[model samples]
Target: MLDIYEFSAVFPSGTEIYSQNVQHTIRSNRRTLGGSLFFDKLLAQLHVKSVSESRPPSANRGYLYPPSKDGNLEELHDKIVSAEIADHYKQSLLYYLLKDCTALDDEEAAETFAKKSHLSHKYWIVIQGLWNLDHLQFEAALEYLTHPSLLPAFPEDILRVLIDHGKLANKHLPLAYYNAVRPPLTNPDLQKSYVTYLAHLSLIQAYFFIETQPVQDHKSLFELLIDDALQHSRSDGSSNVVDELINLPLTAEQEAWFEEYLLEGKGRTYHAARDTVVARRLALGKYAEAIEAGQQLSGRRFNDINWDGIKDMVATSLGSRVEVDSVFNVAEI
Candidate 1:
């Protein structure tokens, strides 16, 4: 099995990949990798089933079955060899399946088999990365996982693992990995997690990232991005998250969505959120609605309101709207 020391020795800049305090952090979070979904995915890809009533009971069968610790390397090896799996996949499968084996020879056999099958070095990197991830060795995992030679397999899972297991200091590592790999984030859960992380980094960054996403996802994620800003603003008055959000120069559709989100959606929960709705309406020349929303804000955080910021937004909004309307009017003419 590839250890952190081996990884650091192999890579030229491995020693500098993480901070000096990371060893203490990793020790505090140490646990078995068997608990991760990555481990289950490895088993799932091999089509390893669990004990069931329909299947007859046998020692070999029980050993091959998941969530059952009653098997050994010999039985697992025999089962893998007999199965109809493709040859290329079999080597990696053997490596992982034999990883937890206590016997020293079994672990060596896995490495030897991988070599015999001529598994690509990148594949070995993936294995080591995932192995480190499993053991909560985050820094080492990042070093291996972010290697240029490997394809982005289980990208969403990799992110989830990093976010789920990593400490606060290691927060930037996930973003680093995301920037390096640029994984396609289609899963909503992964999207939320990544967005939350982005929000933690910067509200402006989050807004820009959300802007780049598919249109259909804009509403929920935009809503989430606002919610994050609101919460951060509420907690830390000097955070500037809200300040950044209001002055974002949102498109017409986004402006409408923002107004609706603040007025009717999760934004309603935060203090002074309606003030933004009022400022936006005033910016876009909706006097009646602006007055209406503004009236509701009276006696609530009156002195705390950012009238200057609102005025600035209105000035920028009027100019932008006039330009857009002028272009449309010319087309109509």
Candidate 2:
């Protein structure tokens, strides 16, 4: 029942108090691998079914009625996803909300929360992406990373995370979509390539950026750009391919120089670093790591792969072993 003002006003130390209470309450519950034993019981008491449940008919559904519960998960969920929910509800309030109620059945809520978070410096999308990625929801994680609302504001690190996972997940989806979807990602914030931009000087550079957008239902513009970059680098006469990104034949010296001069931190739009992540991870049989990487540069989503009701096939293929890091690609960076 806490409003935005009261939630925001809570002292940081209040987290410790909440933790203590949760620990005290859960200490007596039967524990499981995810440490959600007590929390699940609390949710059950509220008659909120788990996301994994195979819902039955209304007449026979046990979830339709459970004891004398009056709490409405739908209403709470509505509040969680409502764009007008609370302008000031971000950060600690959100963290605590998620920590207490991990029963997020709405995927859009996570994306909207990330997009609407007030702080520009903080990556709300990443927080949700890593959480989803950990749970083997690869497509969901990728959506948070590449959500159109986040595209303009996405940082180099987030882009790297996308590339790291996207490259491998490419073949996992249908051919039509494999190339069709990406955040136009051609934002002013990202540093475009010298060969593409500097091919001319001032305005022609701007023209090139404007003219060629990633067409929907076509291969991702970045993937096409990577191909063209390698083609252009052939004239550089440098045979020394970056060993990590050896799969992609871009000259190491040129890309390093470009990243140094053109980029603020990492590869902005066209990053060889992303290519390296995909190449190295795949070559090493890091299926777990690659899947955790999220989307292929092709812009194909994790869910696009035909699961056919096998929700955790990717996880099962790896015998349920998942990466320890919230993001698999972040470690190499």
Q: Top model by TM-score, which number?
A: 1
- What is the C-alpha lDDT profile of model 2 across 1-333, one tens digit per residue? 233333322222222222334333333222211333322332343344533233542422323112112132333333333433333333423442443334423334333433444433234554555444434345675666455554333233233333334334542321111133333444433324322332222223322443454435122323334444434444553323333123333345434433332233334344343444444444456655555443333332211222211214445556653432222322211
lDDT of 1 at 105: 35
How many clashes does each candidate structure show, in the order listed?
0, 7
Task: Tell me the TM-score of each prediction against the true structure.
Answer: 0.67, 0.25
Instruction: Give Cα distance to truth, residue 279, candidate 1, Å.
Output: 5.3
What tens-digit string does per-residue lDDT give for candidate 1 at 133-246?
Answer: 765678888898889988887887787777665635487888888888888888888888899888888887888898878889988998898888777777777546776777
Best by lDDT: 1
Model 1 vs. true fold: TM = 0.67
Model 1 off-target regions past 4 Å?
A: 1-35, 49-71, 97-117, 167-169, 236-238, 278-292, 302-333
- How accurate locally, in lDDT, is each candidate? 0.61, 0.36
